[model samples]
Target: MYLYKFNDPEKALDCFTAFISRFPESGNITLVYYLAYEAAGKAGKASQAETLKDELIRKFPDSDYAKGLQDPEYFKKVDSDLRTVDRMYAEAYELYQNVYYKEALARCEDILQQFPGSKMSSYVLFLRAMCIVNLQPADEARIALNEVLAAQPTKRIQTVVNGILASMDVGDKPVLYADAEMYDARYLKSVRNWTFDEEKHAENTEEDRENPYKVNKEEEYCVVILLPEDMKTMQVLHLQTRLTFLNAALKAEQKDEKGDYQVKKEDLWYKTTALQIEPFANYGEAAVYLNRVAVDKTLLKNFKGARYRIFAISKTNFSVLKRLKNAEQYVDFFVTNYFDDRGQGEIITGRQGAAAHLFKYEADEKHDFVLMVPYRQVNVKKMAELLHGIEPAFALEKETYDDRYEMVVVKNVGTQVQSMEYLQLVSRNKEIFDRLSGTSSYMFTITQSNLGILLENQNIEEYMKFFDDNYQRNQSGEVGVGDGDFVYAKSVAHKFVLFYPNTIDPFKLKTTFEEFNFAGLMVNNVKYDDEHDCMVVSGFRNKEEAMRYFQTAVDNRKLFRSLRNVDYRNFIISDSNFDTMCEKKEIEQYLQFFKKYYLE
Candidate 1:
């Protein structure tokens, strides 16, 4: 009974089967047979379960099991459908493993069609969604993910669904969070205008089959922007500048291509009153000049139609532009062609040209500073306030350009700071801090920092302490704790802790340690002790129980040595190795003994 309760189904099956044979005429025989059949089913011995079912029918025709078998209308239907579903699932699983996503999807679909209301329907749906994701169609993947979320998903399935959703761009327009800070570096520059070319390489071999459709090459452009001076304002300016440029370019090209420029009567002549009656001049030259101006405007607009992405080169210093605090407040402004009716203008920042041109100088190593002033349309004051809250060292100034008000960049000087320092300050000041507090925020911050401070200090103790503290904090919370957090904490410990047995080889140790089951095992630390020729494992709640179990293996020298020699160096053992060392019968007996006495 103890072994059965500990999930040693194989051992429990053997014990129950033997007991059933000895007490065939006993009143408890039926119950014992039922348990044995259940154990057999759990151990994947479907044939053995069927045999037990047959024996129960022959021995007790009037029993419940016998009755169930005699009139199994619902069960018969379920059994027949389940077999087909299982076959389909197996085929789909195999296809998925081989990376044949389209075939796997078709198999999963077939299962749904064949067994509409089967218990395996949910699993089939999950596999179908996975196939869609791997198929590289975001629209279909999002729909599939939505279906999975709507269904009652297992924890593992939910994890996979969430991961897929995280990587996808779903919904209408993307919402830019106030807390979302863009990465600023030259490396990010490549992201702008990033093109993906899917070249089909047809092969002669069957395995090298190509996609049926010719791959289309997609050219994606990212908009980049630079603010004149203050680092804080530039963050906002970069995005706004790109958007404004896109709008302006779109409008300009539309007017030029369609020949829709508005003509005003007053603007026909610059000085109509001063012009005396004169001989007709070559009106064709004036008309040609006017047409030339229209063509130029249209061309400029078309050039702006391409995608604009913003990235600030951190390595270059924009210190000079940081001194314009008294400039006009121009974070937000509107562009107007006040005189033209058909040639109407959309809102554009006056600083569009300047902002776009700054990219040319971003990679210049000689420059220490770059300052960008956004067009008159940007709200300089509001932008300044946001900057001040994020980095107190930055100053904002207002200025005028072409008689229009615009903000100027001032010094971002307060406390000592670096590129990542600014990012941390922004992340801390952002709205995310309100939701992620205490240990949650601490864990996230530490992970996001990527051990930057620890690496800077080269302090292993501090690094280990960080992991230890977070691990304890995570364990305290039942609802909020997540496997991802635990995994991250373990990774940090693995990287920093020197005392842990970092490597495992068959020849190195006389005894083998069982691989730590991530789900069931929680280790605080690994300490090495050269004096005792043993590792002092500590910080477990059930250390006594674990030690008692260890003593049993120590007592049986041959069995103990054999168990100890098992190399569980890698997290998961190979199937061939497991089969070679322990047969089903041997595993059952050992598990039964261990579960009955070794485990608490």
Candidate 2:
């Protein structure tokens, strides 16, 4: 049971089997078999599952365990119904059992607020009423007890509530109290246990995929409010609530993408010992937010506690404190590192050298470029479609124009003279270029070196100046009429079994696939055909299984309209290795990779 609870079901099954072997005659042996059956199923042992089922049904026929097994989805329903609140209530009950009434009260209040829809809420309230009666005034405790009664608790709970009310009415003396101080960190378990996984988050962010080691020593600042020590739980929660309301009001003034989302809502909140609000553009922005919170008239009413010092912290040191899971440590790291008695924007900036690669690029070698006629655009597919008929050169080559754009380039246009003549030909026929580039484009006699420089600096003025100084009039370029949209594509190689016959309705094909389970394919592939007029089904599957798929089409002629196996004239490859190799009008690498990996 211990092993299974912690996700080692196989070992748990082994332990259960061992126990049954050693103690065959134990009267409570059916309980072991019941748990063993569950572990066997979880471990995916089909034969072992059948054996356990037979043992329960044949030997323990009269037991409740056998009767429960009659329902096929019994264990799945059991696992789904056990909510996290059930475990939280147990933890709170344990604290109460240990005579920590104040801690119990805080835990109960947290559970009630955080899980309003929880089935155990009324029970948690009853526990809270018991705690408040000991510490708070009679009126306050009475109000809480009455609220619990209003919730219409269980009969057993109602009896406890009535007893507590009777005792409070008679004005009874308090229970035993612990006078010594407990550990500070334990008291602030909410904040002390939570760690911000900054490194993990950095890895997951979109920009990190390109040169992930690149780090910034200075940017991404946050606001930190030093919460008052020796504060009550209610006071801490109230402050957090007021701050949340303030943030909501600030955000409400801003515009967002207009849509209403139907989502399964979770109140992803935790009681904080110290509050840290984040993601300001810079320290200046963070200062504005912090200052407003301190003096705002609407906020002053709710924030009746001692004045807490609010300040900005750098992403570097603030991450360290959160990583350490000690909010007080933020003060120590701040003083040691970026914090001065100066303004919030005054962060010391010498540490960039240590993490230099994290902030800047490393192009430590000299390089040169080969001249080419590449025209970049936002709609490269539209460019290809519009220009494929006019002249093959206009649509002959399309490939990556760095990370943000793809381009239709001139292939096999060798020397500076050849690139110039080609550029001039397209430049003179301005309408052909204009029609090809839909909106926003860079049509230039660009080099690989020039493109690299553009990617690194992203300064168009500098690049244009450089181009004008180096290239002649024949190498001149033009911008498109409309704004050229920047288009980016990420290509992945998938081995799809495609059949483009003179037809098939996608809906009928999809319905047939739903009715029957096909082997050697993932569900995303099985659910639909790739496109109309073709059946492109599955990727990275066995040829024999794909061959067997033709039989399905043959069996259901209504779904597949005259579909048959035929060799496709063209195959696609996405790797740059294939791209460069094919650039010289060669396709040997593509033939080897495409034929080898395309179908099988």
Model 1, span 104-198: residue lDDT tens: 88999888887776666667888888877666457777888888777776555677688767766554322221212221221233233122121
My TM-score estimates for the predictions, one after another, are 0.20, 0.20
Model 2 agreement with the true structure over 1-600: per-residue lDDT tens digits: 234326777987886788679877654366667667877888898789779888988998876467567765644443343345655766676566444678878888888887774556777888888778666777888899999999987666687788878976798744534433222323344233222235435655754244212123357666666554344433444455456446545664557621111111111112233566766766566656656665553333233333334456667755454444544344434434444543221112111111111122213322222212234434556655544544554325665544555556554443555555555455445455445433444555555455555556444444443343344423333211211121011122232223343344334443344234333342121111223232334443233344355445446655443243433222333323323433443434445544543343
Error of 1 at 439 (Å): 69
Root-mean-square deviation of every model:
33.4, 27.4
Model 2 earns a TM-score of 0.20
lDDT of each: 0.38, 0.49
Question: How many clashes (backbone N, Cα, C below 3 Å) per candidate?
Answer: 46, 7
Give the clash count for model 1: 46
lDDT of 2 at 235: 48
Q: Tell me the spans in candidate 2 whose CA falls farther than 4 Å from its real position.
A: 1-217, 226-277, 295-301, 306-309, 314-319, 335-339, 342-600
